[model samples]
Target: MDSSENYRVVCERVAAAARHAGHEVTLLAVGKTQPASALRQLAALGQRAFGENYVQEALAKQRELAGLGLEWHMIGPLQSNKAREVAARFHWLQSLDRTKLVAALDRHRPADAVPLQVLIQVNIDDEASKSGCRPADIGALAEAVRAAPRLTLRGLMTIPAPHPDPRRREAAFARMRVLFDDLRRAHAGVDTLSMGMSDDFEAAIAHGATLVRLGSALFGPRR
Candidate 1:
């Protein structure tokens, strides 16, 4: 499928997933290595929110496409030094884990901008390589995020272990859901769960993800 045809199919799936989740879906086509034009094409296809994994790459896209009315999301591990620019530019952040990064985000939160929406990334896989706090650590972290006046604790985000066994994936997502529910119980304000990606978003939604971020599924294979 060309970009146009591919976009149609992707938009349908995104709409279905949004309906299934019973929440507003930010289809956030992940454009890590892809060019800004591809992202712009998707934005024309009605995808307003976009996610980028690399700071430099995402920053480039943001700079180039700033006129397109894009809502950029920092969906990868954000370095503490990058927090100021990330907080000032990106509207949503899904990979906030460390306290120092949070502090930096709060300190740099743009006074003229909207309260930055945040999702505490949960290390559901407990992997040594991933960039997230453990499911157990999310609660304490939530307290810290809520205290930041310029930051709004929307909910939780997680990257489950990419295992063949669906049960493992489900367990990881379920663990994140537990933390999501726990936090929601404590503060009714934190409502967004920025979970799921191309491979296992359905399971993430089944476990109660409010936002499912997709990339290849929407834009087709990256060039």
Candidate 2:
């Protein structure tokens, strides 16, 4: 199918999932290795949010699509060196895993811009290679984010270990939902729970994911 057809199918699936889950969910097109033109195409189809893994690539796309009013999310592991660019350019950071990054992002955020929307990525499955904080560390990291003048604590994000069993994945999502609920109770304005991707979004939504990221399912496989 073409991009528009792919978009329609994905939207229909998302709407069906949302209806089943009894809540509204947001879709973030994962534009990682895709071209800026692809993003323009999706934007023309009413996709307003896009997620990118690299700062430079997202910056270029942002420049190319300058006036579209699209929301850019940094959905990959972030380094301290690139915090300034991310703080100044991206609308949201979905991989905040440490206290150090909190300070860097807070310090570099432009005073004129709105507070950067932030999600605490939790390593729910405790994978050694993941880019999120330990589930035990959520509170401290959340406190750091809240104390930062230029960041907003928007709730949790997780990429669970891709277990072969669907039930196992749903279990991880359920755990994340508990963490998200606890976060909302402790922090005012904590509403986003970004924990789904193309393959398992329906499951994620069933467990309370307010935002799901889609790439191949929306734009076909990356070249």
Candidate 3:
């Protein structure tokens, strides 16, 4: 299938999954390594929100397609040195896992621009190599984000330990849902739970993912 066909099929599947999960969900097209032309194709299909892992690459795309009015999201591990760039460039940052980065964003976000929407990435399974904070650190980080003047703490995001069993995947997503609910209780209007990706999005949706970040499932394998 071509990019458009892939996107159409992915959307249909996502709707089915969301219906099963009994909730509305946002589709964040993960366009990390894909080119701007690929993004333009998805944009033609009305896929407005795109997620990118790297700041410089996303910046280039943002410039190339400035006329399309796309909403860009930073969905990768962020460094303190790049916090300012991330704050200024993306509409949403889905990998906020620390307090120092939170402070840096708050200090550097453009005063004229809208507050940068943010998500607290939780390393749900506590993988040593993952970029998210541990479940124990979420509340503190969420609280800090809530207090940051230029950052809006939207909700929680997670990259669970990959598993072959659908039940195991659903279990991880279920844990994220519980944490999401707890976050919403403490912060008003905390709506986005960005969990899941190309491989396990359906399972993530089945467990109540408000946002599923997909790449190959939507754009096909990168060339």
Most accurate candidate by lDDT: 2
Which pairs clash in model 3?
none
Superposed on all Cα atoms, the candidates' RMSDs to the truth, in angstroms, are: 1.6, 0.7, 1.0
**Model 1, residue pairs in steric clash:** none
Worst 10 residues of 1 by lDDT: 19-28
In terms of TM-score, the best-performing candidate is: 2
lDDT of 1 at 222: 68
Worst 10 residues of 3 by lDDT: 214-223
Scored by lDDT, model 1 comes in at 0.83
lDDT of 1 by residue, 1-223 (tens): 8777877876677668667867666566789789999988877877788899988898899988888898888999988878988888899999988777778898898788889999899888889999999767877788888889999999888888789998889888887788888889998688888777888877777778888888887767767
The candidates, ranked best first by lDDT, are: 2, 3, 1
Please give each candidate's TM-score.
0.93, 0.98, 0.97
User: What stretches of model 1 exceed 4 Å from their correct place?
Assistant: 20-24
User: Which lDDT tens digits does candidate 3 get at residues 4-102?
Assistant: 889989999999999888899999998878999999999999999999998999999999999998999999999899998998888999999988888
Report every candidate's CA lDDT: 0.83, 0.95, 0.90
Please provide the root mean square deviation of candidate 2 (C-alpha atoms, Å).
0.7
Clashes of each: 0, 0, 0
- Give the runs in model 2 whose Cα sits over 4 Å from its true position: none
Clashes of 1: 0
